[model samples]
Target: MFALLFSITIEAKEIEEVVVVGAYVAEDIAEPTEDNILETIQPTKTFMLGGFNGIQLSGTDTKHTGVFKNGVPVNDPSSGWYDFGHDLSTGQKVTVITGANSVRFGSGSMAGVVLLEDNFGRSLFTQIAEDETKAMVEYDYFQIAYYKGTQGSVKSTNTENDWYENKTFKAGYDIFNIELIDYYYEYDTCYDSNFAVSDDCSVEGEKLNVSIDHDRFTLGYTNNKSTHNTGYDMESDRTYADITLVDMLGHELGISGQKETYGERERETYSAYYIWSNDNVSVGYRYEEDEHIVRLGLENDGLRFSVGNSYRLPNLYEQFGDSWVSANPDLLPEQGYGAEIGNDWVSLYYYEFSEGIDFDMNSYSYVNTGSYISKGIRFQNEISLDKGSLFVYSEFTDSDKLRVPDYRTKVSYKYLGFNVEYLGEFDKGADFDGREIDDVNTFNISFSWYPDFATEIKIEVEDLLDNKYEFIPDYNSGGRRLKLSFNTIL
Candidate 1:
């Protein structure tokens, strides 16, 4: 095992983006406009169940993860979780960071951050400036798409059939740009509704983004609104602003603030980050109203080391919501510190591999007031020969129930545009309602075929081995189930 590890890490660069918990480039997982990129790329070992149809980071109970779009946090202010059902057809790329502690994202970043990027309008300006064709000079684009999905049922009463519609437009000139999107989704059966079966649930939403770029500075604004209707009703409205600057001395600065109103409550947040970079090292500081974070690191060639401290405030729902469990107004915010080491290696035979180890300690455990500690190690290896390539990834996490996974391994083979992958996990035990649930093995397999450069059809099966497990007692895992997706860009 050590020889295999050594051969893989020999060519690894220290400053390389750690695949397990660091920045991820969207193109590596799927094409732009693809759906569920998070579900496809990140190993399940990093996430646990979120109610029904939601995903939250492993090891943390409440939603401490922040989902940022174009540098602004977009997670539901009240619940602190990004709506997994939100349409992403308009997005350009996405980056997810898990178990990360940073000062730039203030309140709810104890678990991690997910950044969604969309710069279609800005790209159009560059295209017009570079293209000589008359047809390419206009900066206007519009798109419309529809998708449908179905899944078998666990309960005898209902099956899951879901579909959604999407439309978007981008238009603007050189110094300024605007983008708009309209989205809608409906469920055939009231399977996950908050009301009766007769009143099937549906959602309608709209988003608008405007930006101006000049010299070394940029300014932007975003507005989002959504409505959900069943027997009961719910609605949300969010507004946010961002500013960024790059100075002559190689310093980068950014600040963002937001206000979100949901149901009968409203809240606001503000955060900023600044960093100085030189040839071999970088230093940075971040501040949220509730927490302070700092980072100091040095990278020489491909080897890197860094240490940092992070703090997070309790979210609105955890402080006020009344549901299956009541809120605790006296709850204290969680704080922690962590460090990482990484290396990039390349084998003489051209096989490439990378490895990273991370250690984290928190002031309080999820859903409990006691201190908690966790350690994680991850590896990725790739070998290419002829027209085919083999990729392997594995991870191990030693932590408590909310975030415990003994081990996970994934392997994939790609050749001439066809790909197949398998993922499996050995999960630790969890407890609910004072009863301890048994540990279990989980398995999944996925296949993808790209008939051409612009089309993709995929099939994925979850829990292929039928190992029954639950994050919450009586809420058994979705057993062997099948899902299919057809995605394309015109």
Candidate 2:
């Protein structure tokens, strides 16, 4: 995103290096959060729900993608969807693996995998938007973060405000070839009845994790629990244990398991993987939920190629959990295959899903109805100019399935200390079943100023032209919005 890029520039030569605050994303479901941050960060790769509560790969649904922290999944174990964090700032190194390369996690990665790892330094950061403010402080191997947001809907019949609060704590210590990390997060959100799980009710969640790393392997344990105010006594206690054996001359192995007691029902899962890699090539295999997949990849002289299978197992939320829409327990698992070949400048790929799961606006529930074949190409290039520079990136995808677009293009220009970008999405000139979606375009500008060696101040404007179009039916991607960000080395 422009905000992140500007921040990176300031961080490179100004302040002492600090982790980019890339934490939680959603502010309030009653009022969808940033299209500004999430969209810009991976515009062509992701599809959003009109800048609202849902986002996933361009051709995949939320349930098909997974979010992991330090190699453990952070997605709600019950929903199987990554609903909360789309794009907030954090002090972590974020790595995204998609297409055939996603076999690293085996199942439940129909689209991709997002991995987050601790990468912090002594620093302070804060960003403020129209309805929210987030701040964080870090020192050595410790971190504390807080966020608050409030929203009021414009719908006359549902004119009420929703609020959200979040807090995070992390600490780590290393000695004698052994490392220990402790992390905790607390989330609370209350929304109006119309768009809430329960009218004017609160949903709270808590997580704590302890991990130990040794010369040969890593052992981790997590106690995750959350309570949803759905007009009922809804709460669950979940536990996870994992061990990973590091590479000893190109050999690696991993095993993980989870168990959760949800009211009268119980959920459990077990998965593992084995991989072998040297300097320029890697091969791996994963098994989960009675399904197995193999992946292969290689790179040399700025060229890359990969091939593998993708799969996912449905979770309770997709089948029976209640939310803004009804649940469908009849949903089936997803299976697919994909391959890609390209280099640094351009790439071509293909993927086909025999059975893909997704949220169907027509049925108002989850469905295995997005299956189809897709082919695509990507191009990225940069040109230097007399004053600044110009960067161009574009992708065109053709899918036999509905609910997906065929083209996306992004052009950005940097002049002096200011950055401007333009994004355009075009719907395929075809027909489909559910809600009729339309094309959407957005423009943005950002500027950063370093007042001192240890500090930076940046301003950004999203949807600069106030263009309103429908990427999702009946939802209005709001008008222009502004954000101010500041960070300093402690």
Candidate 3:
């Protein structure tokens, strides 16, 4: 079930012209909206290998995707996974909705579900790029943020050196909402020491998250107590709930649950749902894995369609393992079926999987693999010229053992203050680390100006061909980086 079903927040403003399942809308705030996002996650049947990003839709190898905030269910129950590289959520919105029990915030999305909304009307944000430094503040109901970063190997790749830190706090009233987050990550990776992953590695980690929402319900707690100077040493705790049981005739119902505990294990209960939705359709039932689903979508004359079926299980750190990673509690729960059709430009999809769940980066385990299929096509366009705007996106894939690309493009333009970009990866069949690639291009240029209406300043230039595209094999892909920033509304 290598899935990708990420948005439907309030029927996405009454089905904004549907895309057979929409997403890729980062409205209203800051950055990190994709730049090696598990290999550029812009929908199109994603299947990025290594370093986390999963939902076994096809050649899928794990990380059963399911992310939500402002709707609860935020992965990481020790390792259910969700690491958009420290998830920089500033107006975070990325959508995708492929079906068949794709999502309703239950059963960890079984290979899909991404929704993160923070509703920021702006009130102070700062960024001083290059090596990373950020700040954020919002008053009238509290909000605070800070981030620090260091990446790749400033000391050498095989010599490894990575770093990270993040902190956040939030509060709101009227319908209640509360959140807290903290994390520190440090890593020293290795693999391709000619195969045999894991050779003198070091990892340090810690995380804390607490959430509360209302108007019905959603509560969460996560604490991955850690200290692994060499590997495998973690303490965990995860508890989550989603509730809202009312609204009869017109539908709308809900229920969810989760539980966790690490080490000497034994308290792993995760999955329990019963949901029903309205405006289109969505049905769910999980009652601890006896799973069931029904999903529907529509938009006639202008076209748009969808089909569903999916299921995923196998997390408890992929069945009892983490750190140096390795496990498989008889694993088995990746099932699939899909269909999609598009309109707003183009769209097409296909998925098929059975007892699949790969992820054997050379013995890092988690297999239950076999029978996989993936198909894709996506095209997007937006040309709102008057003064600015001209977006174009692309995707193409065919999957089996997975690592696809027959075309993957992205283009951007913004006029009046510049901002031109382009990305390319054509005919790749194995580039996400299966090796064998052909072209990998990227170009970026930025300029923002704006001195008034709140304030602004910007400058950027990334990889204009500093060529060194490594999407996670031995790290260090920071070929050419330069950034400068300033933002406003304070």
Give the per-residue lDDT digits (tens) of candidate 3, residues 1-490: 0111122121222222122232222222325322323333343222111124444332233454566655556566556666555455454444544433434555434334555555545567676666677677776656777777665552235555455667777665433345565656555544533445553444455556555555456676766665545434677777777666764664556566767777666454544444454444445455556766555555456665656566666667667785467777888877766666667677777767676765687778777877777777767787898889988877776777554555777788889888877777666565445556445676778888997988777887766667665543344443566777676766
Cα lDDT tens digits for candidate 1, 100-195 = 424445534544466654433211110011111101112223333233332222222444543455455555444354556676665444433443
Off by over 4 Å in 1: 1-29, 32-35, 45-62, 88-91, 97-102, 107-112, 119-140, 154-231, 253-255, 322-328, 345-368, 401-404, 434-490
Rank candidates, TM-score, best first. 2, 1, 3
Model 2, 1-490: lDDT tens digits are 2233223321111111111111111111110123323443354423322123444453555666666555456566556665433234455555555546534454666445665455558888888888867777888767777666543432223445455566767665441111122222222234444545333444565656554433333445544455556443344445655556554787778776777555455678888887776556777788888888787777777677777787776766667756555868678887888777777667777778888666677777878875677778877677999999998978787876555568888899998669898888787454445556667688889887888888878888977988755445542344576888888889
Arrange candidates by lDDT, highest first: which order?
Answer: 2, 3, 1
Off by over 4 Å in 2: 1-41, 44-55, 84-87, 129-131, 150-164, 173-238, 260-263, 319-331, 359-367, 381-387, 400-403, 428-433, 469-471
Q: Which candidate leads the pack in TM-score?
A: 2
The estimated TM-scores of all candidates read 0.67, 0.75, 0.29
Collision count for each candidate, in order: 15, 7, 14
Model 2 local distance difference test score: 0.59
With candidate 2 superimposed using the best TM-score fit, by how many Å does residue 489's alpha carbon deviate from the native? 1.2
Best by lDDT: 2
For model 3, give the 10-residue run with minimal summed lDDT.
Answer: 1-10
Span of 10 residues, lowest total lDDT, candidate 1: 126-135
